[model samples]
Target: MATKTADADLKTASVLAFERKLDPSDALFSAGRWDERDDPARWAPVPVREKSVRGTISNRLKAKDQDPAKLDAQIDKPNLQTVDVAALPADADTLKVAFTLRVLQGAGSPSACNNAAYQAKLRQTVEGYVKAHGFIELARRYAHNLANGRWLWRNRTGAEEVEVRVQHLVQGAPATTWRFDALKLSLRHFDAPGEMTETLDEVAQLIARGLSGESHVLLGVSAFVRVGAGQEVFPSQELILDRDSTKKSKTLYTVADVAGMHSQKLGNALRTIDTWHPEAATLGPIAVEPYGSVTTLGKACRQPKEKQDFYNLLDGWLLKDRVPAPEQQHFVMATLIRGGVFGDGE
Candidate 1:
């Protein structure tokens, strides 16, 4: 009836613990979403160490090396070699903290990436820019003056003649000048020979058609023989326009014959059309061989009437009413239209 009088007794169960080896790959601990899991919250937050005494010692050593003069001012009665890592915060990780110290010590001004090849390329590009822009400016000036009918002169001898002059201001007292009369364009006092030569040649061709009178006009470079000391003369290369020899006796052509020669020469130089093609006209009158023989298709075609017709056709093609082929039409239209548009824009 007393329920066997409860005795103070306690029973304890035995606990068993087992250790398992993890696979080499599975043993990895990631700080963030290092797997395919997109949820960043699933990853354990990385522990941020508050301070490191080892890092401070390393920083002091680095500072001493970097600025020895400033180190004495910063720490009086300093024992930089005896700085202890145990003095730092409890959560400090020396290895990671050392990395920060190294980073700070290594920081300085960025180094230049200079090399000979790169410098040469840069110089070439700058030179190209100057040359190109200079040519463009020259062309623009010429076109503007032409449009304004400024300084346009006619050939007194009747042979087509147009002259262009470009003067470069030289820097010197008692200034001396070098003159180049190529293609009837005079370049004076140009320091850069190559640029001056190229520019003068181009300008000369531009005005070649308008200049008529002589058998050959100056082109490229020419040497002017000075008659006396301190007297400079310019000798320029001449571009000649002569008729085929076979037609010399048949036609009564004069200095006026070179009217459309410039355009022909340009077309030939450009190689847009075959030389044999009648449409492939020269800027000047056709060249006549010494004995008045005309060369056509490697055959000597002799006739005054044919020569006259050839020149007439050329003139028509250049200035008069002649429909250009589709290719030529497009080329001509594009050039003329662009020129007109640019003129308008200016």
Candidate 2:
């Protein structure tokens, strides 16, 4: 009996899937005084309420409806629609958002896979990459996002001061805590500033350990934003499909009437660490995605034509035995850590 050649065994798995390593719960919103942040028990949940507002005809009229008289008549009738809104109380000067993140182990293992040969080969490949480079870079970037309050989204914009508290949870209690002056960190880059580098390293090490199957990591994150009294805050918008115009025009996400941000939204912010793509020099870091897609921009930074997308790099590395550059390898591994189904149709 002759041994099978390596080339013959190299093939793309038809059913391969990876589980996401970084999992976060929905962020709940609350209101309190900036000074009262130490006493979170007294904080009140931010409630989502409905309000009716007259819509202005700010949208450009079509050529057919551009007539001055018709436009005046249309403007005269108030476009009344009900929308949901959340705001801080007049007495409250701060908004507090809290969430839990669970970091699981087994970064390269596939949750679902059919081909044993391909799975074994892929595992070996990932192991090789791990031996060459650890997950510190990726982990550090994630830590930066958490510390900088990137998950606060619009709420962080006009905040007079923003503070983030990250606690290492053990047995449902904080074992260690790290505080960050969020506005001091820039979101455009992941460079660790001098003052916060040491603390960030500790957080990154925990996350990397979790990813490398060394330990399970649980983080409790709380962000406090001082946006002034009675200011409105933005929550995740509910995507309502197939609804009539008479229904509420806008819907804010809520958990038991308390305004909340979606877990998916928080996850997206955490994984916004893809800065190795071709256009990254000009576009800055984007969310870690297979295609380097930025939905808001309606463009993919890593185009297949450039052979930089996840699929292309993965196939070349596994099937063609063409190893990517160091930076590109990091991107590929980050995508795997991000997790997705990547199976060849053929």
Candidate 3:
């Protein structure tokens, strides 16, 4: 058929890439009194300390190693190891996590695209989607993630109190500020309860404007976690490969000797909004990856065979001129916003 010939001629771009729009700086950790939260400047930086501990033989042993004599020998061998840790000083009851985020514009515009026609069609499709649905849903989910302090990660567990403050920065000062009782917001869903809806809407609108190229949006986020004096706080761990056996077994992240989390980790938490993938009903929302990959779960929800992965959906839309369903449109757009190298192979 003529249609088949045309399709065959219209190959995917050999070089297509997009830069990430939601940018976040490294999150630095500080410690202070719950009452002294008003003066974050006075807070002391939480420092990573090296600790030595004998490892416990608690891991499940292989069937062959389950022999009582072998197990006893393993337990007798001291697994001495040194690791890095971060904890609040005895005088401090709250951990202050601070970071900055910049929301850049241009969601679907590829930074590199060899195929001009495909690029044009892609832009047109993105513009159409923008006109029809806008970025409200995506923006709202991002705002929810901020309000809930999802970026706090392991430090959020069993906290006596958690407060998140988001400030819209303009000209180096706060133009608008929103304070959230982070514990009250559920992490499982994007919905904001009635009382927080108005505030959440304001934040979402600002994010939407940023994504739509209406304005530059910069946010300063500070989370105060009341984990009690001397309680341990969690910072991102460093992944050391091909390590020397004598080196520290665990290494935590730090910025200038201050405990910190990676910007990539924070960005991952912010974009955890892909609930439209096929397995979402049972698996819940996941970070918006092209393959709907949940690294922690070791599963890819958007399988190619299901024709739900980004390439399949995107090729169908741009090459075949088949507009996907509303939810799928959102997924595709969200993936564009997430941004990455997505070129087709020659």
**Candidate with the greatest TM-score versus the true structure:** 2
- As a TM-score, model 2 comes out at 0.97
lDDT of 1 by residue, 1-346 (tens): 2312211121111221111100001011112211312343543312211222221222436634567666655455443221111111223111000000000010011122233333333234324433433223323323223221122111111212222222222232212222432223321111234545555454434333212111122222111111222211111112335644332212211122211112222222111111222333432222222112234445432233553232233223333435344333323221221121111011
C-alpha TM-scores of all predictions:
0.16, 0.97, 0.96
Error of 2 at 153 (Å): 0.9
RMSD of each: 45.5, 1.6, 1.9
* Candidate 3 per-residue C-alpha lDDT over 1-346 given as tens digits, one digit per residue, 9 for 90 to 100: 9856765677689899999999999999999999988985779999999999988888888999999999999999999899999999999999999999999899999999999877877888898999999999889999999999999999999999999999999999999999999999988888788999999999999999999999999999999999999999999999887697448988999999999999999999998888899988888889999899988889999999999999999999888888899989999988888889999866
Task: Identify the runs in model 1 with alpha carbons over 4 angstroms from their true place.
Answer: 1-178, 181-197, 205-223, 226-308, 311-346
Better of 2 and 3 by TM-score: 2
Which predicted model would earn the best lDDT? Answer: 3
Q: Candidate 2, after superposition: displacement of residue 204 in Å?
A: 0.5
lDDT comparing candidate 1 with the true structure? 0.24
Candidate 3: where is the Cα deviation over 4 Å? 1-8
Model 2 per-residue lDDT tens digits across residues 302-321: 99999999999999998778
Clashes, model 1: 41
